[model samples]
Structures are given as structure tokens and as C-alpha cells.
Target: MSECCCGEKDIYLPELATITRMQHMNETELFLHLELDSGKELGHMPGQFVEVSVAGIGEAPISNTSSPTKSGFDLVVRKIGRVTNAIHAMKEGDKLGIRGPLGHGYPLEDMKGKDLVFICGGIGLVPQRSLINYVLDKPEDFGKVAILFGAASFEQRLYQDQLARWAQNDKVQLLETIDKPHPEWSGNVGVVTTIMNQIDIDLANAISLICGPPIMYKFVIMSLEQANVSNENIFVNLERRMKCGVGKCGHCQINHHYACQSGPVFRYSDLSDIPEAI
Candidate 1:
């Protein structure tokens, strides 16, 4: 056991954490909660991500879905790649390599007292959930919160239970939509951007965060600007094939920025000059 930057003592390098629990969000999706052997905390910021590795497989950049205030962090893994598939097969008590609650996390300091619009698409909610839950913990530190989420289908919705709880919160408004709807569905059906139409833009003192696939950003950004949110006030979370979890890896490079370090989370202003960011 070693220690993490969070000051928890005897935490192993990078750290050796055990799989405390696992939940299947759907047929091809899973969420894992790893408990550190030293009983130390990951001490991560909301929107900060982690680098997880499975022995004999490989590593993947994953977001910290749990709030920083919580004892252990949560990672939502979708079985689209080899490492994730390996992760999905593991159960409680499995050992894995952990490096980081790395990269620059969300800007919680700037968000204080500002109305927030959380526009998420697909598994975008997985990363945004970190900030969303953090805001809920200290509800008074922020203003109104609206979550606009979209997925390919209902079955693809991540964290359905948590999203429902957000919708139930008086301080939060969770608006969700699907690209294609089933006969049993009745909510917004076009896209996540459509929910933006229902918002009363409070751009003078509001901030917006957008995350999802690359294609989702083009339309979402255009819609946010129309609602009067400034380029500086809007943030986007970019996904890339990250390695090293630090800037050393070239895999997540966006012009001069390294998505793994400069961010898996970024403000439009920081990346406005980076052509590949969008």
C-alpha cells in the first residue's frame, strides 16, 4: 500500500483497487466501483477521469462517475472495446491497475452560483454524472440545473436510475431524448438538442456543458450559441483513444492539446483554436 495525492496513506502505486461492486446498466454496459485496499480515497474532482487497466488486456480512459465527496469512485464501462469487454467479465475482488484521477477535471469553482445546463448525449452522461452529482451534494452553491440527455435508444440509456433521481430533484431538471423511439416511449424523440428548445435561456448568468460523440457537438454548440451562451461559458468533454493518462501519449492529441491531459474535459475557449476539438 502506498499513498495517493489525495493524502490517503498506504495506497498502492498508481494504486491497487479491488472491484467492490459491479452493475450492468444494460446488456452491453457495466458500471464498476473499485475500493482501494488501503481504505484511501481517490480524491478526484468532478469530471476528472481515471486510467484503468485489466491484466492481460489493456487500459482505457474512463471517467469518474461518482462524486468526489464519496468514498469510492465509479466508472461506467461500455463493452465496445477489448479492455472494456474484459472489465465487464470481471467480478467483485478482481485486481486492476489504476493511474490517475488524472487530467484537469470540471471547473466547479467557476460554476458556483451560476445556472447550469448539462447537455449530454449517449454515454456522455457517464462523465457528466460526476459534476451533476457533486452539484447536488452542495445544492446551494449553484443555481438551477437542467440535464438534457440523449441516447441511440431507450436500452442504451446509462444510469437510468440516477437520471430519474435528477429529474425528481427540485433543483434539477433532467430532459432526455432518444434518436429512435420504441412504441412504448413518449418523451422527446428527435434528439438531445431538441430539449434545448424548451429552455428559457438565461445566458446573462448561465453556463452550459456538452459531451457526447463528435457529431453531437456540431449541432449542440450551434444551438447553445443561439440561446446566447458565450463561447467561454460553454464547455465540451472530448473522447479520444488516450494512453499514458498523461500528456506523453500522442493518441488523444488535438492540434497542440492532449485530450488525456489538457483534457478529457475542456472549455470551448481553451480549444477554440484547436481545429480537431469539435
Candidate 2:
């Protein structure tokens, strides 16, 4: 295989990566830690995803759940299809093929010194965690940080220990809720949007990042607009639309824009002309 000038192989070819750890976060989700066999870091920024493959099972695009500042990369895979099912069956010492740190990432440089409000629902938190950790790791580079997460129920929550830690950290403010009430849960009991009322940021100087089910976008954007947060200051992660990490497949197209190429992350204002996007 011919190597690119960056010393990596062709983007279409999968490089071998070894799984270093695996943890079951819930009944359907598996958290994995991997390192490239080439002994080099994945060198991914927050919000980029990688294409993972098993020998006969096919490939799927999975987001990097960890920040680039960390030693190894992480992914939280939901057992929904053949590729992910095969991934869940893997063990700690197992190996898989990785193709990228693909797609455009969040605009971290522009976000410096601006307050951030992260809103996530269900498994959408997987990709958002990357940027969350990146900002937390360098608190002085940013302003206030707030995270609001909603799950179907308390039992469906991912990264319980980390959530607990973020809750305890004075530098971060976290609010978690569920769609419906559970006997063991005494915290907020409502959809993710319900907690927006509790946010206390300076809307004029704040930026909001949202990632969740397709259905949640409209209402969340409405809530943000009602609160007077500018569309230019709002961003969304559409990583779920990615099929082929490279733009050739056309699966992630929204009108003339290729989400995988131009963005898995986009400023809300830029998508105004693309009705199908959101």
C-alpha cells in the first residue's frame, strides 16, 4: 500500500488497531478503547469519527468518544447492526480495522473564551463527550461550561462514573434528566428541552452544541431561538447520518452539501438554505 505524505496509508484502506479495553455501559452499548498498531496516535480532534471494520462483517462509522489530548481513542458503540454486533462480541486483546479520523470537527479555536452549553439526548452524548473533555482539559481557554443530558430512563445512562465526576466538578455545571420518571430517580424528570429553562448563561456570549435524535432538533432549536441565542452561535452534530466516511457514497448528502465532507458539525445559521438539514 502506498502511504500518504502524512505517513498514513490510503484513506480507503483500513489500518489495524487493537482494542485495549471494553466496558458494558448499558444493555445495548459497549465502550471501547483502541490504539493503532502502527504505534502512532490516532491524532483525531474532538468530533471526528473513524470507520471500523471486522473481517467479514463489513464496516461502520463510529465517532471518537474521547478527546485527542488523551493517550488512546475511545468509542461507544450501540449494538444495532451487523458491524456493531460483531464489535460487541470482541474482547480486550482483539483487533479491528480503522480507516480514519474523518470529517470536519467542532470549531474549537473560534469557541475560545465563549461560554458553552452542551445539550445531548440518548446516545448522542457519545460524540459530544469528545469536545466536552477537550474544553474541560483546558478550562482557561474557555468560559463557563454547562452540560444537559437526557436519557430514556436512568438505567439507560452512559458513563455513570464520569457523569458523577462532572456533577461534582465546580468548574462544570451538569443537569441530567429522563423522559419519564423512575422510582430510583429523584432528579429532573422531563425531556432534554425542559432543562433549558434552568440554564443561566449570558446568551449573547454563549454558544450551544446539540447532538441527539433527529426528532429533538426542531424543538431544541425553537427553544434556543426563543431564548434569543443567535443561530450563528448554535452548532449541531449530525454524525448519525454518516455512512461512508468519504463523500463518494452520497448517503450523508443534504441538498448540495455532503455532511461527511463539509460537516458532521455545522453552524445552525449556515444550514438555513438547506431545508432538509436539521
Candidate 3:
């Protein structure tokens, strides 16, 4: 019953998603906790994203940072453009237009009982955190767990609070690095690939999930290859500009496949020929 950023309303229109709480992680980044007007729990899988619209402004895709097991979800919005900036200006109780929990999520069911290695970089952790939390909730279902994460600088780190907690847990291995190290820091410095060199993985039973900027892929994949991890065992999430969350929009297409539908999450072997994809 609230106004949307977009004036248009119909089946293509979005339902109301009210901001319940807000956390300002940094200047440009904010995490919004949203509850639906339908009063039904927002059910979505890890790696899926929602199209958020500000009334009379526009809509942009934002990935879910919270676990699917929860009643509500959290969105980490980066205020880099118009629509996002409009969303950033909104406050708690503001109703934003939400289109979907679109895109195919990671196939976590297939990963059960396998040693899971998560390689995340910067804001890539947004979606990756979902899988991480799912695994943490049912740690006994999987084998050894390791998370190798990196950020540009100390201030650029995402989910610092969770990272700190992860670093302390004994059941899993957590290694983090920043490109530019500060004097107060003593942790690993350099790229996340450096963590690959130190961890001992069972190549036969372990699988690695990679998510990050395009530049991080080649190097990370190369590192995984060096470690004898098979291409089939490696999965990746590819990002594309999506206008429509469904396959009807050509914006997210990569050759024959649609990143919004067929992927966003894919086995590396499935993308062996997609050059643009990393």
C-alpha cells in the first residue's frame, strides 16, 4: 500500500518490500533488512538476486546476503549509480519495489558430503555468504571447509564481523588478505590465490566455488588447476547486466545460455568455451 520508485504497476510490477532495519557498512555500502508486504517469508536460494526499484527512480539488481533459512533477507546495496543511490537514500519503514528472487541458485544439494572450499573477493561475498551460512548451519553434513577471501584494502573488506567470527572457528579454515596492507595488520597480504598454496585439499573429494571480479577468476582458476582440482569439481558464479530478471531480457545472455536463468551459478566445465565468462 506504499508508493514504488517506478510508477508502472501490473504483473511486471513489484510487491512491497519494507525496510525493517539498516546497517551502514561503509560510505557506499548498506545492508537492508527487508520484510515483504505479503507477510510471507521471503524464500530464496543462495546466489539468487532481487530487482529493487525506488519509487519514481529505477530498479537495479542486488544480491541477497542473508541465509535462505531465515524469514526475511538482507541486501547489500552499493551506491554507485542512480537507482542504487535512490535506494541508499531511503530509510527504515520505506517501501521499495521488489521484483524477484530470480536466477538459478547454487546447487548446494550436490555439494553435500564434499569438502567445500569457498574463494571470495570483495563484495562477491554477498552471495557467497549464503552458502557459507548454509554450510555452517549444518557443518556435519559436509567435510572439511575452507574459505579463502580477499579485499582491496582494510577499509574495503566486506562482512568484517562475520570474517572475524569465521577466523576463530576451529572447524573450518579461514584465510584473508588485503591488497594494500596497513601497519596495524598482520594477516596475509597479496591475492587470495596465496591461500590456495597453503591449504591441503583432497582433490578427489573436494570442490571449490569461486566468486569475484573477472580479474580474480583467471588467477584463481589457474591456482586451482595447479592444485590438481578438476574442472568439473569447480563451480563459478558469473555476473551479467540483467534488465529483466527472467530470460526474456537479452541483457544477461552469454552466447547460447542466459546468465539470469541457466546460470549466475555454473560448473566451470559447463563454461569451458565462454571466453567472456570467468
Candidate 4:
């Protein structure tokens, strides 16, 4: 009923975003697409996340995989804890609170004209998909592009339809693998790091952005280094508990850096000294 900071009138303050779509992508993963009455675009950059709240149940930080250009956005969530379990029970059109498209996103400006290599693992592919689809929309703005994705198993792959389209792009080199294989799967079978063996990188001109669990980041960075990519050119997305999307909540801090504000996306150069980043 009042004017908002952006000079907009009567925005829904995020609490009114009725869940328009909700589905289970896997046994452990749930996808929620909310349509807020705010009528304001998320206006977020790729690699960012949002804080979702379900009344008395509490809240959790979930990465946004759908590009900002997409109608609303998509959150690929894996329920491992309490708050997530409540989120899983929600049905379409259920109301929930959403704050942000928070945290720094990928270095898209720096990516212009650079050969971009995306190394995504597990649910890590969610954030990577945002940057991937964005880059594809502006093809000539980049140089040689490649995507190397790995997951725990064939059954856990996310966004299989879009992955197929990316594979069809002549200018993009797409390679995907899984640690364990299924009978119908014909792709490589090993950790995602194994795909590194199939591509040649000009470390001087190449940049890699990776997302995954702690162990995956450890080994992937090692592989990228062996391929000669400088530590400075490597970026990562760090996820920690986040309550407030803003800096007020102490949950997302890692020492002096607030993962909600300063990251969720960060270059290795800035993180090289932060052991917790591992």
C-alpha cells in the first residue's frame, strides 16, 4: 500500500509469492517456481541464490538455477534437513516468503571474449546452468566455450533437456559423465574431473567456474591447476547457511567475508587464503 525503495507501488514484500510450480526432480530433490505478486523482476545475475521462508518452519538458502531472463526462476533443492522437509510438503499456489537473488554472481563482464570452461558436479550443475544459458543467449560475446559436467550417477542428472540443446550448439563443447553408470548410459563413466583429460586448455586465456560439494571442489581445482589454469582465473560458488538474505544474518559468514553479500560467487584468488572455502 506504500511506495517501495525502487519507487514501485504495492509490491508483495515477498510473502505473497504463491508457489506456481513444484515438482520432485529426484528422490532427494524438489524444484519450486514461485510467482510473486510484486510484479518486479528478480533482476539477478547468474550464480546467485535466494532465501525461502515457510512461516513457522524457518528458512533455507537455495541457489537459483534458472536464468534471470526466464519468466520467474527455478530452485533445484535437495532436502537434507528440517526446513527443506517443510519446503517439500508445499503444494502449487502455496504462499512462501522469498528474499533476494542475493550474493555476487558470475563475472560475466570478465567473461567477454574469454574461453569459458564450466566445471559442474552434482547439484552444482544448477548454478552452472544459469551462466551457461546466459552465455548461450549471447554467443558472439564469448570465445571458445565448453561445459564439463559430472554427477554421482546417471539417475541424478539435472536439466537433461537443456543439456541436450547445449550439446547441439556447434560452438559449444559439451561433455558429461557420471561416477557410476546405468545400462542405457553411453557417456563417459568416471568423476567429472576425468573429462578434463579430453579437453586442451590455453590456461593463459581460459577461465573456469566450478560448483559442487567440498570434496569435488578440492579435486577439481587440482585438476584445473594441472591443466595450467591460473588460480586467479578460477571461480567458485560457496554455499553456507543463510537466514537473512542481507548481511544482518550471521549464518552465511565465513570469517570476515559474508557469503550472502560478498559471495555465493568468488574467485579463487580471493579464496586461496580462506581455508574454510574448501
Q: Residue by residue across 158-217, what tens digits does model 2's lDDT show?
A: 889989888887778898999989989999999999998888787657999999989989
Instruction: Give all TM-scores, in the order shown.
Output: 0.93, 0.95, 0.93, 0.90
lDDT of 3 by residue, 92-127 (tens): 999998988888888888898898898998888888
- Residues 2-65 of candidate 1 have per-residue lDDT tens digits of 4466865432246778998999999887988988777888889988888888877878888888
- Which portions of model 1 miss their true places by more than 4 Å? 1-13
Reference-based lDDT, each prediction: 0.84, 0.90, 0.85, 0.82
Instruction: Order candidates by lDDT, high to low.
Output: 2, 3, 1, 4
How far is 96's C-alpha from truth in model 4 (Å)? 1.9
Instruction: Compare candidates 3 and 4 on lDDT and give the better one.
Output: 3
Which pairs of residues clash in candidate 3, taking residues 3 or more apart in a chain or in different chains? 4-55, 5-54, 5-55, 5-56
Candidate 3 ranges with C-alpha deviation above 4 Å: 1-11
Model 3: lDDT of residue 182 = 91
Regions more than 4 Å wrong, model 4: 1-14, 200-203
lDDT of 3: 0.85
Task: Choose 2 or 4, whichever is better by TM-score.
Answer: 2
Best by lDDT: 2
